[model samples]
Target: MRRLALVLLLVASGCRNGGAPSTEVAQPPQTVRNPVPTAYPSEKGDYAVTELVHGLEHPWGLAFLPGGGVLITERPGRLRRIDPDGTVSPPISGLPDIFVDGQAGLLDVALSPDFGRDHWVYLAFAEPTFRGNKAGTAVARGKLEGNALKHVEVVYQQEPKLSHGTHVGARLVFDDEGHLFVTQGDNRVAAAAAQELDKLTGKLVRIWPDGKIPKDNPYVGKSGARGEIWSYGHRNMQGAAIHPRTRALWTSEHGPQGGDEINIPRAGGNYGWPVVTHGIDYSGKPVQGSIGRSTAGMIDPAYVWEKSPAVSGMAFYTGGLFPQWQGDLFLGALAGKSLIRLELEGNQVVHEERLLTAREERIRDVRQGPDGALYVLVDAPDGKLLRISPVGR
Candidate 1:
């Protein structure tokens, strides 16, 4: 009876239309046999976690500096520097006006690959309109000096800013070739925009560090398409990283209720969102305009969570501190309140381990420090910067 009711609800919500016929089928959902375990043991060794600092207001992003200091961004529109000895600097000044409402605000921070020579810092944030109501994701770059950003300039801005604040996907990643990849969400009220070629929403865009569209971009010379779009048909892609070995871009997207995804976003790839998805609506009904779980032309996710973990930041573990963990993938979970580690063989995830479940804190961002230690940012009114190391040595 329960299954029948769900089928009826799907039909009523119009879940079976507007998709190309396909022979491919979506992967079966994996159930969490044990939702939360007391301890997470790995093949390499046991883990120890240290709280380096606390008292942050919903810290969202983290970047390690050349001189051993860490830069952290708060979602409420502040940036601060934390020294190696755990001293937190006051909020850095000279950031542009940021839209801070609901899920919108200062999102991610990154240092330019040439930071040693250029000192350029890149930031992804929610940019507001002159009216200060509608907002969209934007990227800016500036030189860092003392406690402030100097000569900040907007590099890229998503078009058609929406009034809603949810689904502001703003993860920033730089590829080995010095191209900047910016992820944008569908703005909660605009899922259909993901499939539109001319719109920037729900897309992954690649640009030069100076915000110029690359000539080799998939849509560079295409008619009626945004030249900056590298790939389309994404949902809310909050987590992104470049594979250390492959140099390919991997992203983690948030689905409506379930169906959180891990994807390798290829140039011009279409990742089905409302057209095909493994998840239903928040109200337990099928997503509107969704056909089945697969479509003929859209690329299926490389990995999916049947139960939404509300994934956020992700990193590739290339550091040598954990020899066994090298080449693995680490992701921070907001809903699951844990750090997820996936063992990968090439691009395939063969094993998954959830860490820090005992603490039950929302993990926002995860990164490998200069010293090869795993660092994480906890999202809270009293957020914390945590360092994860081997139990000994």
Candidate 2:
């Protein structure tokens, strides 16, 4: 793999409350790379798809930089930068040791909301235990220097790391109040952990950028409950996006055989997982311990799929390029192998459209670029970064 050292313009760390430390580095000039374009038709209109770059190894998370650059994370513990012109940089250095195994490793990446000023980058990955036998999801942040991260520190870690590998929900999102939300999945072997307030598994946690637990967090003073927890009882959430109009945090979760869900998680909310679900087990039997589809204390999903699409990344389209798609929700589907677009009437999904079914690619992540176009990452050994723009625009 190419390991190019490109310097990024650095600024003084104006972080409050002793945030991640910063370093001084010089910036480099920007250049554009040629794009290979393809066209496709969608429900709203025809669009052109351009392959900006390729050869990524199971790229999972993607975050856009201030000046059209993108930071992408590969599942096998590598981070790369993609320039606007389609140039992919080499693996960035300074990441913590990741526990790479089945459905684990370097996962999601996000820029601090104040990235232009602070240059802080956040990451979620499967962190290994001392013995290297058990692992759990962890969140860390660092200052983005030239071609590496500096002063990286783990902000939060899941308690009681487990030996299993699957169901490590690792999506990161920042709410309107600047609070960071980290999604966690119930490590497949511990489904009941989702219902326990003492466990971080299968829960969404809210914290300050500097790792401080917010005083107003749902369980701050509750006995035996972790203060960072915001909501619980999720299976394996992989997609999260802030709603543009309502400013609420929305997420997509994977179901067993069916019953994939989209939820607007609220403070202290509990969306039933093992206790209740619409999906059956992989063996075609009912989910173990599930009493019914709905229960008295457990909150129901805002929307659910009778068939699992295996949703991953998600974004709310507020860009001008797709005016008709404004306020619509777009989710990347792994098993469905397409980009799923949902027409939303407030919080409800009114209509649905599946795009890129012809390509049959496992869409890993999706975001609307600053240029008013949609960008998606394909999950594969030879993954691609593709930009979708309205036809002839």
Candidate 3:
């Protein structure tokens, strides 16, 4: 009884003097990151879509915390946080020097496999060179402390940073074996680099989480070949996800005019980016002397979209909130302004469904949160973080 009275007295005194922290968590800020009620139609009927966080500028990546928080990365080189209670924090400090160019900046963020215990996070960003003019994709590892990143370290960097912005493919994926895969672009300045064995650009690299080359990687001991190369001859690949059942790494990349492709990448494979494409150049001319769609030695995509939708981020749905969506792949589209759902049977896409067409939001990143809910980040001047769940679930 005395303890209860003392607690009540303390609460009263704290309220009177405004000195004690409230037991109640802070509410979502009214000016920013506020919940905006919205109803959007989907194949499942009218569903509930809530804008949980707003006022973000061109958000590119999102990762949910196991404890109920979220980390959002803005392409303009800022990393923001959303507390468990829905309060958005200011940009966390201690990020590495980011080269914020046209298509480059702080990109993807992923929690380490042992993140619950180690609290280590990884980021992919466009990094600058010694000259301070050229830049390319790089990966860094850091420890997340209170509200700042501590003990940050650069783990991997693509060589020969060039001075362009359109194609710094920056997606990070982790396999079950703890190997990290990084997707890079052709750097735009040299498309031929994609076919070269020595260059790291325009390729998928396999490395240990700490940036060491995996000994079993396809190119590990090959002379004149970068040791980290897992698969070569890729264009600007930005979206990659591991299939839940097959454990295969599937990637989607941008094509010239209309040859966006979805591929199941293979070890030491050549994707024939510029050599053979169904797309045409920006000038409406056939790509590279009309190389046709196939070559004897090059591999073909598992699926090709004749009309490019500008696919961005992707994830395989395994949540029970939407039972019908299990085993399907969800891809965010920037130019198409919709969330694409692809029904997969084994390794083939059986059917495709477009969702959120009415909202017409440029979905930059799509992720399945820890709570079995779907989260998407819109890319815009006034970007928003959205949560998607069943109407009454």
lDDT of each: 0.79, 0.82, 0.77
Considering summed lDDT, which 10 consecutive residues are worst modelled in model 1?
4-13
Give the Cα error of residue 117 in candidate 1, in Å: 1.5
- TM-score list, all predictions: 0.88, 0.91, 0.90
| RMSD of each candidate relative to the true structure | 13.3, 6.4, 9.0
Off by over 4 Å in 2: 1-33, 84-86
Query: Which ten-residue region of model 3 has the weakest summed lDDT?
Result: 1-10
lDDT of candidate model 1 versus the reference: 0.79
Residues 1-393, candidate 3: write the lDDT tens digits.
000000000000011112232222223222233344466776656656777666666778877676666667777666766554444565566666777668877788887988999888888888777655767889988888866678989999998676366688878999999999998888878878888989988889999999999999998888999999999878888788899888989998888788888988899999997888878888888876447999988999998888888988888999887887889898889899998999988988999999878898999889887667788889987787777877754
- Tens digits of per-residue lDDT for model 1 on 229-327? 999888899999998878899999999899999999999999998899999999999988899899899999999999999999999998877988989
The alpha-carbon deviation from the true structure for residue 373 of candidate 2, after best TM-score superposition, in angstroms, is: 0.4
Clashes of each: 0, 1, 0
Better lDDT candidate (2, 3): 2
Candidates sorted by lDDT, descending order? 2, 1, 3
